[model samples]
Target: MELFFTSLLNGVTYGLLLFMLSSGLTLIFSMMGVLNFAHASFYMLGAYFGYVISSYVGFYPALLLAPLAVGAIGALIERYGMRRAHASGHLAELLFTFGLAFLIEEVVHLVWGKSPVPYRVPPSLDGPLFTLFSATFPTYKAFMMAVSVGMLAALYALLTRTRVGLLVQAALSKPDMVEALGHNVPRLFMLVFGGGVGLAALAGVIGGNAFVTEPGMAAAVGSIVFVVVVVGGLGSITGAFVASLAIGILQTFAVAVDYKLPFFDRVTVSQTAPVLPYLIMVLMLIARPRGLMGTRET
Candidate 1:
């Protein structure tokens, strides 16, 4: 019982973290039809930025400042680099971003070295939040869950209840029409890209200390994020949310179990946990290519 409950909690927490990262990618794709290959690089930047800012000021201020700094960088990238690539087509955009990922990684190596930085959780949230049947859940994990939920709520309200959201949605489906109405469609695209990466950075700010803060962190979670995005549906926020939690729980439980497969008796479930998300993605694509809550076919 204790293991089950602990795994469940851990799964949800991990899933929400995935959502925090995926939501930004979903927004950018849904709004601009641009799949950012360098999205995880921005996430890595967030953690490093948060670490530096927090060291100087504190976690609270770093929480706000790091994302803003990354967002501004994202805006500049979109304006100068991505904007030019957009004219050349999707392949150009993809190649640009793919190369940008390597560039960011090299920069991190140059700046922070190859070693993992000592990015610890805030002292205030350092201890266990509660105990369940001898299994203690960390306060930082609870804090992560709260932030993830809060972000979801805020994003929902922004898209559904605000004028800016309406414009964003309008621009998504009808960019020319929005531009005809005097809206700067190109500028909107820049903001959408910036905001998308900002969310990724926000995830990095929180997740870096929760997990590890290293230069390779982006590469580590980068593929899983795309799995979440694809499994949740290409451009569906709700689909992403559902997929994140499902994958989170599935992998968490798999790590806890030791059952062997029928034919592969040498491989335990725990040993296979690392491959679970990709396996699920493959199965999802085969069974329902549109994804759980996705509106369009992939």
Candidate 2:
């Protein structure tokens, strides 16, 4: 029972991390109607950039600054590159992002080299938050959960309560209408895209130390990020939130087990282990195509 509670808590923590990544991806998709394939690259960049900042200053400042820098880069990409790519079509936008992802990874390798970098947990947060039933939960995980919740709340309030949030929401509903109203829709798009990338980067900064800060980390988490967004439903931040948490829980729980079927316990095999998420996603695509909490498409 204690172990179960521990895994459940761990699952929730992992889910928040997923939320941080998927929330940004969902927003970019909703605002731009173009999949930013390089979203995870920004995440990788955040980790690397945070490492640099951490070396110079401290983890606290690195946590705050790295994402802002990545946001700036994302804005540049949207303003110069994505705007041009948008003219060609959604396919072009996706291809552009894919190319951008490739380039970013290459740049990362160039700067950080091909080897994995060590991003250790901060000494301050390295210890356990508390021990329950002889199980110790790290303080950093609690800090991460707190940060994710804070970020999600900020995002929610911005989208629903603020004027810019309304504009972005309106923009999502009808970009042409928003533009016709004399709003700089393109700039709005760039801002949203930048904001989205920034959120992903923020997740990167925190998660890098918790997980591993490495070039390959992006590729490892990238597809799962997409799955979270897709499962959450396009154009729905609420859905994204729910999905991010759900995927995070699912992934964390999946790794916490060593199980066998009641009847098939004797016939154990590792081949069917890792593909559960894809299977579940496929089921979601088939059943709830728009995803839970998704609004009707315009």
- Runs of candidate 1 exceeding 4 Å displacement: none
Q: Candidate 1 clashing pairs?
A: none
Q: Candidate 2: deviation at residue 232, Å?
A: 1.3
User: How much is 30 displaced in model 1, in angstroms?
Assistant: 1.1
**Model 2: per-residue Cα lDDT over 168-227, one tens digit each:** 889877888989999998899899999999988998998888888888988998898877
How much lDDT does each candidate structure score? 0.92, 0.84
- How well does model 1 score by local distance difference test? 0.92
> Total clashes, candidate 2?
1
TM-score for each candidate, following the candidate numbering: 0.98, 0.93
Per-residue alpha-carbon lDDT of candidate 1 for residues 121-144, written as tens digits (9 for 90 to 100): 999999988888887889998998
**Maximum-TM-score candidate:** 1
| Candidate 1 TM-score over all chains jointly | 0.98
